[model samples]
Target chain A: MELLGRETRERFGLRSRSQAGILIFSLVSTMMLLSSLYAAEASVFKKAREAAIETASPILKFFAGPIGWIEDRLGAISDYFRVLEQNEALREENAALRQWEEEARSLRGVIAALEELEAYTPPPAAKPINAFVIGEANDAYVHSMIVNAGANEGVSRGFAAVDERGMVGRIVDVSPNAARILLLNDVQSRIPVFVEGSFVEGLLVGRSTSQPTIAITKLANGDKIQPGQRVITSGAGGVLPRGLTVGAVAAVDKKEATVELAADYARSRMVRIINYKFPDVEATPLGAPGAAAAAAEISAAETAPATAADAANLPAAPPAAPAPVDEGD
Target chain B: MSTRADVLMRLAGAATPALLGFLGVILLASPLRLFGGEVPTPVFPLIIVYFWSLYSPGHLPAASVFAMGLTHDLLSGGPIGLWPTVYLVTQQIAISQQAYFLGRDLGVVSIGFAVAALVVSLIVWFVMSLMTATVLPLGGIFWQMLATVACFPLFALAFGRLHRRVVIEV
Candidate 1:
C-alpha cells in the first residue's frame, strides 16, 4: 500500500512539472512574437540592436578574415577548372555590351542637348567611399551585411551602397567604424522603382529571396508592364538617387512583378558607399558655398585690378582638400 | 586551495556553452560566402545549443540559450525576439529528450537534431511569412535545413572530442 501511494505521488509530480514547462514555453513564445511584431516601430529595440551589432563587429571581422581567404582559394581552384567555358561566356557578353554601349552613347548626346536647352543644373556628383564587407547575415529570412565603413567615413543611414555591378543596399545602421546595409532582398526593404521603357512607377519590396516583389503601385490605367523591362530608382521619397539601376523584371502577374537584382552580392568583396544628398535649394547655394564665394570675390576684384590688400581678403583656395579618409581595408 | 581549483574548473566548464554559441553566431555572420549559390548559411549556433542542452543541460541553462538566440537576432538583422523564441523552443525540446540522448549514440543524436532542425526551420518560415504578409518561397529554407542537418555530424564529432578530452572530470 505504501509503495503504491509513493509511485502515484511521483507520477503526479512529474506530470505537473511537464505542465509547468509547457505553460512557460507558451508565455515566452507569446511575448517574443509580440516583440517581433513591434520591432520595426520600436526605437528602443532598434538602438539596443545597433549597440549590440557595434559591440560584435570587431570580433566578427577578426574571425572572418581567415575563413574568407580559405573560401576565396577554394573558389579560385574551382574557377580554374571552368576557365574555358567562362571565358567564352564573357566574350559573348562583352560583344553584346559593346553594342549597347554605342546606343547608350547616342542617347546620352540627345539627353545632354535637351538638358542644355532647358538650362538644367545636374545634381552634385556622388562621392564614392569604398569599404570591405566584414560580415553578413547568413539567415534566409533577413538579408543584410556589415561593412567596415561607418559614420566616421561619412556613411550615413539611407546612403546607397553599390558594387561594380550595381545596387547592393542602403546603409541602415552605422557606428564609428562599422555600418549595416539592408540588402535589396531583405523582407524589410522597400524602394521606389520605375520600369525603364514604360516609366511605370512601382514599389519594390524585398521578399528575402533572390527576386524582389515589384508592385506597380502608381501607373497610368491600361499601361502594361512587360517582363524584361529594366528597373531603376525613382528617387520619389528622396532616400536614393534617381536613375540608379536596380534590376530587371523577371516575371509579372496581375498584382506584382519580380526583379532579379543586378548586383551579385554573394560574390562582391568590396562595395562603394554613394555619398549622395538631395539638393536642398533653400539650404544650399548654386555651387559649393565657400568656393563660389571666393570665386565671386576674385572675379569682382579682377573687374578693376587686384591689390595686395584685395588678395589678402580673398579666402584661401578651399583649404587643401582634406587628406583622403584612411579606409581600413 | 584544491577546492578553489575545482571551482575554477567548473566555472570554466560553465562558460563553454556561451563561448561556443557566440563563436557559432560569428561564423553564421561571417562574410566568407563559402557556398556559391543563394542557399542560406547553415545555422552553426543551433548545433551548439542542441549539443550543450543534451550533455550539460544544468550548466547551460535555458536563459543562456535565450540570450544566444537574442544575440543572433540582433546581429542577423532579423526581427528582434524571433531567434530567441526559436532557440528557446528548440532547447526545451532537446532538454525533454536529454535522457534519451545521454547514451551518446551519434546516429540517434543526429536523427534527433535533424528533426529539431526541421521543426525550427518550419517555425522560422511560418513566422517570417507572418511578418512579411506573404507566403515566402520555401526553397531557401529547405536548403538551409538540409545544410544544417548535413553539418550536424561534424559538429557533434568535434564537440564530442572536446567534451571527452578537455571538459571531462580530470
Candidate 2:
C-alpha cells in the first residue's frame, strides 16, 4: 500500500516537471515571435515620424538653414585649402571622361539606330526613383544601412539597388519614409550571375564578412573557369536585368570563386535604381529568332495559317537562308 | 514636510540608468570603432551595466538594460538583438557574481570584470554567428574586451561615490 502511494506521488512529480519544460519552451518561442513582431512594428513608427516631420517641414527648414550654412562653410574652407587642386585635376580628368563618354554614346547610337531602322524594340520600362544614402554599415558580419528614401519615395521591396560602380543590394524592408538596404556582404543575400567568358551561370552569395563568398552550383567536377573574368546578371531569372555588371572573379577559393564587386560599397554615397521590366520573350516575336522567316514564308504563301491558333503559338521561323544562298551565290 | 530630500533622492535613483546609459553608449561606440580600426573602445556601457547590477539593481531594471542594448544596437549598427541579449545575460551574470566579488580587492575585481566582459562579448558573437550563419572575426572582439576590462577600476571608482550616496550603508 505504501509502495503504491509512493509510485503515484513520483508519477505526479514527473508530470509537473514535464509541464515546466513545456512552459519554458512556450515562453522562448513567444519571445522570439515578439522580437520579429517588434521589427515589423518599427515600420509603422517610422511612418508616423515621417508624417510628423512633414507637418513641421517649415520649422525644420528654418533650423536646417543654419546647419546648411555650416555645411557649406566647412565645405568651402576645406575646398579652398585642400580640394581646389583636386577639383582642377578632376575637371581635367572629367574632360577626358566626357570625350570618351561622347564617343561611346555615339557608337551606341549607331548600333541602336541601325537596330531600330530594322524595327528593333526593347523590353518594357519600369518606374525608378533616385535615392540618397542616409547611412551605411560596413560591419564584419552584416553590411547594410537605412536610406532616408522609402515606399513613400516609390521604392519597392525586392528592387535591385545599385550605384555607377555596380550592384548594391536589394530592398529587404521599407517604411513610408525610410528603407533598409541589405548590402552585398550580408549572409542572406544572393544573386544570379553569368560568367562572361564561359556563359556558365550560378549564384553570388554574401557572407556578411568583408569578402563575400560566391557559390556556383552548375560547373562540372573539374571545370576550369579562369580568374579575372567578368560576371554579369544572366537575367535568366526574372528578377534582375541581363548584362548588368555585378562583379569580376577575384579569386578561385579551391571549390568556389569570390567576386570583387565593381561598386566600392565603402566609397558609394548614392545609388541609382535600374529601371527594367521582365520581358516575356515567349509573347514577343523574338522568342524564336527564325519565327520571322517562317512567319514571312507562311504569310506570303497563305493569308493565314491552316490551323486557327494563337498567333504567339506559330511555329518557329524557317532557318536563315544557307550561307551559299546569299545574293552573290 | 518630508518633501525636498525625499524627492531628490528618488529622482537621482530613477535617472541613474538613463544618465549612465547615454554616457556609456558614447564611450562604447569609440572602442567598437577602434576595433574596426576606425575608432576607439567604448567602456561606459559595460561599466554602467556592472555598476547597476552590483549596486543598484532596482534603478537599472533588466528591462532598461534590454532597452539600452537595443539603443546600442541602433548606434553600433549590430544585429538588433545581439547587444540586448548580451546586456540581458550580462546583467544576470553580474548579479549572480556580486557575492563572489563582494569584498574582493581591486585586482580581483578587475579580473572578474574582464571575465564577465569576455563572456558577454562571446555571447554576442556566438548568437550572432548562429542567427546569421556566418563566422565573425574574434580577434578584434578580444582586444575590445581587454580595453573594457582595463577601464573597470576607473569606472567603479567614479560610480562608487554615487552608489554610496544613494544607498545608506546597511
Best candidate per TM-score, number?
Answer: 1
Question: What tens-digit string does per-residue lDDT give for candidate 1 at B69-120?
Answer: 7788888778877887787777777877875788868999999999998898
Off by over 4 Å in 1: A1-32, A100-120, A281-329, B1-9
Question: For model 1, which pairs clash?
Answer: none
lDDT of 2 by residue, A129-220 (tens): 67655544434454565555777788767678888878888776566765667777776678888888875778888865455556776775
Using all chains and alpha carbons, the TM-scores for the candidates as numbered come to: 0.82, 0.63
Q: After superposition, how far is residue A43 of candidate 2 from its true place, in Å?
A: 12
Top candidate by DockQ: 1
> Of the native A-B interface contacts, what share survives in model 2?
0.03
TM-score of chain A of each: 0.75, 0.59
Model 2 lDDT vs. the true structure? 0.63
**Candidate 1 residue lDDT tens string, A1-329:** 99999997996786456436544754775686687685665877777767877888788778768977888888899899999999999999999999999999999898899898754556689999999898898678788999888888999999999998879999998888888999999888999998888868988899877888787778787777788888999988877998888988899888889998999987988999999887664554656655765776677668635445445676542332233433432
